[model samples]
Target: MHARIADRGRLRKVSTRLVHEHQVIAVDALTVSDMVKNHRLARAISDASWRERRGMLKNILAAGPAES
Candidate 1:
């Protein structure tokens, strides 16, 4: 639980900095659901938290004023 919380905090910080530093952000379109269906890769993919990072980026971008 503590680790998850820390990870989330770090992700938020990093995402905010990334959005503020760049005028545009681009990410590959990934089929996460399908990729997760593969048992061998599921754990690794989930641990990476790609969806959470993307969501954070979107929320930060939507919240206005990226400039510091």
Candidate 2:
């Protein structure tokens, strides 16, 4: 569940730093459905964890108006 407590509370600190570094990026994430169709890249893409982390970032941005 996305609402489930974040992993050991580290996500927030890391997410915050990432936001600062990227400056409120509006990433165009790949469609995992289509991505998973390719066997060659599926494993690599899933291992990267970009989708999950991106989701977390979205949640943060949704909750607050981030600014420098």
Candidate 3:
């Protein structure tokens, strides 16, 4: 239950980031956000809370690429 809640919060955070960063984003739903955010949040939390921050970031950095 706690993990589910944290995942939900992470998804919301990612959706906001996407919309705020990409003005033309059309966030129809959060299913997309779930996958994307999971990868990101996992990476961020791992880095911040673990000693392998750089390794975690390098591994997950390509999870989201900037649009051209």
Candidate 4:
């Protein structure tokens, strides 16, 4: 009975870690999508005679610090 309880505790910890990891992965995917969308939008605007669009993108990109 004691061994079973210990196993349950370990399983719970593992499950928690797995859930957190999945959340992080989801957030990362969202960030990547946002970045790609931003780039495309910026490029489209730049192509459409908006010279300031690239500068806007640079400014926006500067806000997102590199993640470890």
Candidate 5:
């Protein structure tokens, strides 16, 4: 859904959608930065946008939209 938009916007949209649509999203609790320090996985990790995605997930789960 983010072919044309920036990564930041893409992450936001995905997280928002998942939070609203799904009741049970499983996010890993690993430390992305530390794990990405591995040379073998650095490129793959960077391309996946894991850090930003994780942050978005945590934010939405912790404090999602207000109830009507």
Candidate 6:
């Protein structure tokens, strides 16, 4: 539980920094559901948490520039 919380905080910080550093962020179109169907890659994909990070990026971008 604690680890998950820490990981989320780190992901948010990283996402914020990336947004601040780059004007445009491009990501590949990935069908995560299909990708997760493959047992071998499922764990790796979930561990990477790409979906959550992408959502974070979108939310941060929509929120506009962060207060200094």
TM-score winner among the candidates? Answer: 6
Candidate 5 contains a number of clashing pairs equal to 0
User: Comparing 1 and 5 by lDDT, which wins?
Assistant: 1
Ranking by TM-score: 6, 1, 5, 2, 3, 4
Residue-level lDDT of model 6, residues 22-43, one tens digit each, is 9889989898889999999899
Q: Show pairs that collide, candidate 5.
A: none
RMSD of each: 2.0, 4.6, 14.2, 19.4, 4.0, 1.6
What residue runs in model 3 are displaced by over 4 Å at the alpha carbon?
Answer: 26-68
lDDT tens readout by residue for model 3, 1-68? 99856765565455545544764643232343344467757665543332232233333343555521
Tell me the deviation in Å of residue 37 in model 2.
1.5
Query: lDDT by residue for model 5 over 1-68, one digit each (tens)?
Result: 46736768878888889888888988777877897899999889778977678888888778857720
Candidate 5 positional error at 66, Å:
2.5
Taking all chains together, the TM-score of candidate 6 against the true structure is: 0.85
Model 5, position 15, has a per-residue lDDT of: 86
Candidates 3 and 5, the one with greater TM-score: 5
Candidate 4: clashing pairs of residues: none
Predicted candidate 4 versus true structure: per-residue lDDT over 1-68, tens digit per residue? 99756755555454444444553322111333344467657665434422233333334344443410
Runs in model 2 deviating more than 4 A are 1-12, 65-68
Clashing pairs in 1: none
Cα deviation at 19, candidate 3, in Å, is 0.9
Off by over 4 Å in 6: none
Candidate 5 least-lDDT 10 residues: 59-68
Off by over 4 Å in 1: 66-68
Off by over 4 Å in 4: 24-68
Model 3 scores a C-alpha lDDT of 0.46
Q: Could you give candidate 1's per-residue lDDT for residues 1-68 as a string of tens digits? A: 99999999999999999988899899788988999999998999988899899999988888877442
